[model samples]
Target: TVIRNAWAGDPYPIDTLMMYMSNMAWNSSMNTVETIAMLTDKDEAGAYKIPFIIYSDAYYSETVPFADLVLPDTTYLERHDCISLLDRPISHADGAADAIRHPVVQPDRDVRPFQSVLIELGARLGLPCFVNEDGSATYRDYADYIVNHQRTPGIGPLAGWRGKDGGSIGKGDVNPDQLQRYIDNGGFWHHDFSDDQRYYKMGNRAYLDFAVEMGFIPCAEPIVFQLYSEPIQRFRLAARGHGKVQPPDAERGRIEAYMD
Candidate 1:
């Protein structure tokens, strides 16, 4: 839909699309030819009529030539990454978890991790959190941000042993050697909950409290499962000409039919 709107110049919200390790061919899992054609569409002036695509991928693929700008990225073994609860965390039914990927070998090519490029771009753009009051870059690189940028006073992306001696967990002062601690501990962290806190995690009181402390939930409270959603109701009201938040006419039918 975004590509179609952009190609048609229908006042689409996006002027540019920055994709990282995304397969445009597999997006929406259907309409591959249409998606690619719309993305590569040109105006009468021979410029891209659709959103200007900036793509990053570690390897060459079928989607590369269509991008206006292509950033070469390093393999996973050549970069640092954090899988945090704030994003798509790696966890099991027994516990909430997070992990890191530290570079084991240096890349011989002129490529960097896509994340590093994004951090550099953020600093260049002077993004609020990525820049200091004096306009200096807040972090030197992705690894620096992983170690120093606190989500709160002390907590950061990693949930492993924190603080000076690498002894604390959950919340603590930032440890300069935190990444080394993780590397020493085999490049991942796992916190297993007590047996009483395992089952019915979403609604369980004990589990909820643990989740909050580990930066999973905003607060420890029973998570009520919604059957009929309020947003669906809002969309329905908007369709009836009754609310501020209204979906476009083309989207109204789908919004009105939302069940889950």
Candidate 2:
């Protein structure tokens, strides 16, 4: 959910907020918000539905007129759990689930436990109709499910589990005891496997995750790629035949040398 932080006064127009959202890399998937509105059309009718943005501080300033029942959740202190799915391998953390996220310190507003609110919401929504039995969505140990599904070779469970004794990592690795080996070798894995079908590289594909990461495509045109390489502007970094510069200017064997 992208909640844009409103200023004290001189409130900005909705168009401004919309433009701000369109320009930023964070909310590039503008359609996700629309999709949410579309998906819960059955449930919400004309009311706003749940937003699914990675960042929560983006939707604001008269844009979401359909918003109803706003729930103000706390920062790190109020959360009883956490998640650990790093899109890039470089950002790994241990015990990503457990972070001492208890309410021992207390809050300025109504002081209530996090678990209670979740249980209440579940009862109201009537989700997971079978297992919950009461035709409600129970708090199904989301933290546990997160730890189990999002394991990425190093991070382990929150409680009742010990990390590698020899400083190795394993939870997400394909090899057995690889996690342990990583620990023994000071957090490093020596994978000996050669290139297989999994390493498939195609010149061009219908779609790619990188297109999103690079911000070359937006949610409005999720299936389309923006013209990053204008033929009018030549580039030396591009490969021989792939250079965007049109013929006679920077095409193969035409110019004395393709300048950077």
Per lDDT, the best of the predicted structures is 1
Q: Could you report the Cα RMSD, in angstroms, for every candidate shown?
A: 2.4, 15.6
Candidate 2: regions farther than 4 A off:
1-66, 86-104, 111-126, 129-260
Candidate 1 ranges with C-alpha deviation above 4 Å = 1-15, 26-29, 43-46
Per residue, candidate 2 scores C-alpha lDDT tens digits across 11-66 of 33121111222323323435556533442343236422233222122234232333
Estimate the overall C-alpha local distance difference test score of candidate 1.
Answer: 0.80
Model number with the top TM-score: 1
lDDT per residue for candidate 1 within 60-87, as digits (tens), equals 8666777889999988899999987567
Against the unseen true structure, what C-alpha lDDT does each candidate score?
Answer: 0.80, 0.33
Worst 10 residues of 2 by lDDT: 7-16
